[model samples]
Target: MNFLKSTYGAMMLVGLLAVSCNRDEDMQQGTDTEEEQAVETSSEGEDASDDALEMAYQGEHQLSVSGGRVKNTLCATVTNDKVNKIITIDFGDGCVGPYGRERKGKIFIAYSSEVGDSIANRIITFGDFFVNNKGVTGTIELRDVSINADGNLQSTKRLKDLTITFPNGQKVVYNGSRTREWLAGAGDDDPTNNKYKITGTVTGESTTGRSFTQEIVEPIIADWSCAAQGNFARVSGVVEMTKLNGYSVRKRTVYYGDGECDNVITITTFRRTYTITVDN
Candidate 1:
């Protein structure tokens, strides 16, 4: 009986050792599996993060405008990446007017979001106009323009100030509510009997207290009988002009041309009036 008891105890001891060994092996395997899974998960997360960062570094964009008396449309494509970025704008054909009379200019875009959202500034430079052998160049500084989350322009804000420099080196500055109108065919109408009017005012260092009114007309003759008598036909008219805070002035002129009664000549005249106030 003593021998049987000792043998039974020994067998029980062996069984417990076997069970412990199995349990330890299982625990080690479980730990290794968990660590492997963690590494795989971390790698996947890093890949996803890299993909998101790459996407954020690149973007595509466009801009367009329509409506108003002037049918003007402008579009731009911008490609931004970490290394380099490029932007190209297309101010559609006929954007300004007829052939030779077009609105061809370069628009510069600069922005900074680091400033407060209440104020966004921009500088616009106009190179020249295509027609009239004249150019319209200016710099407009705008503030408080709206933008979207991706740094895209939403709408134009109020004009803080404006500087216009004509081709003749004439400069004008103004601070007021100014809006742009895109006339479809502003100065390209028929020259025989077409008449048009353009009125505006400028205020700044050169034209602080000045305003102007201009009228454009096609060919017209007041004395046709003179042409039939082998004489020149003459056109006479009075142009009404005004200055800022000043009375209107009527300027009269006569235009003559040598022509026959049977044949009529078409002529177009572009007139502009300036009311300037010199600084003391």
Candidate 2:
């Protein structure tokens, strides 16, 4: 009911937040090396993994669904009002990458099951989730959410005529189910368990004022490797996008990012064969 107002609120939030956060450095050198590495991946083997596009204001150096690590720019305060039976999570300021960029918002949810010191697989509906700061801004309605025993998130998000605007005044109206997971965990020196990796689908118009459907053929991999140094995370998969800037084309896309938390991930299509900067 309050989607449009919240969206505008989110946009305004970004407009204000953008002036505060420190800007990231250039990523050109990082891109070149990765491009060269991608060229060699086919002959070598499959990449480590894809990344998680879902952003939760959890902690610093959390594992991403894409297999990389995420540094939470905003360490949200989690408060549960026992009397009211409500859980309020404030995502103050943070970076959500492979996409959805940096965000600062809040989520209000109510759970049916008992939520203890630790929330494990607790099914909760009626979530008022909002994320916006720099790269992305939007509110997500939680239909149902349950975190596994392993602390991996499994949930369905609703986007009711939600609009996510890009830098060029173009917007994407996302309306669909965002089923998600915590793919990989934060691991340093090959740490085995943490939270990394996110996979799901949002179908709708690729840009504002356009109508079409796009379905990813498989789980698009968001790869954030284990290495502590270097800005390297990628989004790779085959998608059938019937309308992207008015083009009906289904192609495999591989996006390489500088891991700068800047929402800028490179796009490479068709069998690891080309490179294009984000929104360039």
10 residues in a row with least lDDT, candidate 2: 43-52
lDDT for each residue of candidate 2 in 163-188, tens digit (9 for 90 to 100)? 44434444455556645455665334
Q: Estimate each model's TM-score.
A: 0.27, 0.47
Model 1 lDDT, residue 167, Cα: 42
Write model 1 residue lDDT over 27-72, tens digit each, in one string: 4443323322222221111111111111111111122122112222
TM for candidate 2 is: 0.47
Query: Residue 231 error for model 1, in Å?
Result: 40
Where is model 1 more than 4 Å wrong at Cα? 1-101, 113-120, 129-134, 146-173, 178-245, 248-280
> Cα lDDT for residue 124, model 1?
38
RMSD of 1: 33.9
